[model samples]
Target: MQPVVHLAVGYLCYAAYTRLHHGREPADLPALVAVFAAGLADLIDKPLDAAGVVPVGRTIGHSLLFVIPLVLLVWIVASRRDRRLLGVAFAIGYLSHVATDIPWHVFSGDFDELGFLLWPVTEMPAYTGVKPLGTVAGIEITTLWLEAVILVAAVACWWMDGRPGVGLFRPSHRA
Candidate 1:
């Protein structure tokens, strides 16, 4: 999926969540921002793909290094009310990027000696093969899909939060 798609999906989904939880009102400004930004990150995959830095359908984007710290930082800075939702949204949106890229390629369990590079999905075991990019099982792997979902999600967040805006940039949401 693309950023536009992710944003749209995220917005619709977030809207549903807002309606269910806090009525038609907004959720949180920061949460929306984080989710939106996370969706934006999906764009990076294109360059990586064209460059062949990693296999198209591999564990390239499935990393906790960045999102984990981001969540922790937001939690530390934000108030109690905002921290939980904000962190969760950001993580989900970020991972949404990974979810979108599942169907594009086949996941082989073949990895390098260090187990970092899993190129040969065919040789790998049963669990080794994974849908690298797509909405399958709610995991993202493509920039387009994640970005599209997050973009929509951010809009929903803005609608729900209804307050001093977090920022003017509402890209997409995912994960």
Candidate 2:
């Protein structure tokens, strides 16, 4: 899945969770936190892979192994901080990204490609295959169309939800 899709899905998940659990929309901080969480893995994975420090793009950050410790750590700290929902939002966003990727590879008939999900426990061969869209220097029509559809869906969903705004650049004054 692309970054925009991941972000949209993550935000949507958080919004749904909030609406169901709290009977209201999410606040700015948690919503932004979820969006950042969704794209966080890619921020780490892409850099390391491009630098040749990792054999595969989906190594550490994209693994269940990675999620376990981080989630536990966040849980402990957030519980102590009395911010448990923030932790849940983080996990939800992060896991949403992972979840989206799995079905994509599976649907694309790349079952063996999912071995990278195990990271260190599973040795991932260096991926020499052409990327879905190489870079901004060139564009792939298929990926462009897919991204366009996702962008529209994400915007539509957000709009339907009254456009929950996550004021990431502003401070939250919650008690």
RMSD of each: 10.0, 5.3
Error of 1 at 95 (Å): 3.8
Residue 20 lDDT in model 2?
Answer: 92
The residue-by-residue lDDT of candidate 1 on 14-127, one tens digit each, is: 445556776764455634653474465455544565687745423333334444565567666654655666655555566555454343333322233212122333221222
- Model 2 C-alpha lDDT per residue in residues 52-117, reported as the tens digit of each score: 998778889888899778878887888899998888888888888888777655545666777778
Clashes of each: 56, 0
Off by over 4 Å in 2: 125-147, 160-162, 165-175
Taken over the whole model, the C-alpha lDDT of each candidate is 0.48, 0.77
Query: Which stretches of model 1 miss by more than 4 angstroms?
Result: 34-41, 57-59, 62-82, 100-175
lDDT (0-100) at residue 5 of candidate 2? Answer: 81
**Residue 162's C-alpha lDDT in candidate 2?**
63
